[model samples]
Target: MAKVHAEAQKEQILNAAARLFIEKGFGGASMQEIAEALGMTRTAVYYYFKNKDEILTALVEEVTLRARRLSSRATSEANTDPKEWLRTLVHQHTMLILSHHNEFRVVDRTEQQLPERAYRANEEAKRAVLSNFTAAIEAGVKVGVFRVVDAKVTAFTMIGMCSWPAFWYKPDGPKSAEEIADTIAELAVQSVIRPARRQLKSAGDVSEALALLREDLDHLSLMIEKQPKSG
Candidate 1:
């Protein structure tokens, strides 16, 4: 019970720090401010985290590790449908951002504040996540489902689209996270899909189409000419 309570307290401290960081940025927020937010003494806050940097590191590492695990799992599921895989990836990422909006905002806005080793570790995890997205897109292209010019570029674009919500999402907003996720996923898939081909028309058919278009344009011009001229 003591162990569980200790863990809970640590989580509470992290949550308070994340909120403060989101409000004031990692550089702007101080340990005393975080402690005050939690209604705890500065020393008590220090008991869980030695300083503001430690709290930021913990939050960034936690989210990065979660993302890495999710991407690794998605990569391992080799037989998953490409479209479904992309949808699941976007949905899961959006859900993660929504659940940890404050942590994500801090990570996104204050990555430069992380310690050297922590920054490198976070970058490695992010690369792995990008790898999974690239692989999923490549699979879709190979199966002739996606029409991307470059899988890596498209993967980055889709990731940017999905991650942008972390900076702006509000819990009290009109749309739920799931709804936003669905819309993003659909847009991502559609962005890479090939457009349907139009039916082939022979020379005679093309001439007839052009003639019909000219007739319509001439009628519209006549209608415009008949309208009273404005002074």
Candidate 2:
């Protein structure tokens, strides 16, 4: 129960931080503003986060973690096809940004305020996301499913294309989140999948990989669910 409450409180701080950071850049949103948003004192907010930088750091790490957590499964599983894995990655990422657009904005726009340690941590999380793409690209190339190109560059390009959507996506715009996700998945697959290379592996091979990831996410979701409600 304590763990649950702690998680809820942390989320509360994150939510407040997201709103404040958006309304006011990193400099404009003070601890007092965040506490006031939550009807709490600055000290109380401090108890949860030492300072606004900490909150910003948390917000940035949150997005990176979510990105890594969602894709870890399909990428880690042995013998999974790269292109389909990229499809899953694109789909999950599009939904993630669109669903949590506010937090993602913090992820995309504001990070210079963080200390070197926090910045490195964010970079590490980003690297983890990049590594997954690199691995997927390598796997696809080896399996003859993707073009024999620069895996590192292609991976970076793929990830950049997928992760850059939080800047302009609209929930009520021309396309629903689902439609956008599908399009992203299709484009991602088409771009990377090698032309004339039709040696496709059955989904069953990737199922285990996907399940491995689902397990990780389920664990994460459960951990979040168990957190104490802090309203």
User: Which ten contiguous residues of candidate 2 have the minimum total lDDT?
Assistant: 195-204
Tens-digit lDDT string for candidate 1 (1-231):
999998888888888888887787777888899888878999988888887778878887668878889878877875746878887787788788787878877787788878888788889999998999999899887766777559888889988888888789998999998898889988988888665233232234767677878988999999999999987
Q: Can you write out model 2's per-residue Cα lDDT over 72-142, one digit (the tens) per residue?
A: 87576635556677777778877877777789778667666677887787788788888888887788888
Q: Model 1 Cα RMSD, Å?
A: 7.7
Give the C-alpha miss distance for residue 32 in model 1, angstroms. 1.6
Residue pairs in clash, model 2: 4-227, 4-228, 5-228, 73-213
| Top candidate, metric TM-score | 1
TM for every model, in the order presented, reads 0.78, 0.74
Give the TM-score comparing model 2 with the true structure, all chains together: 0.74
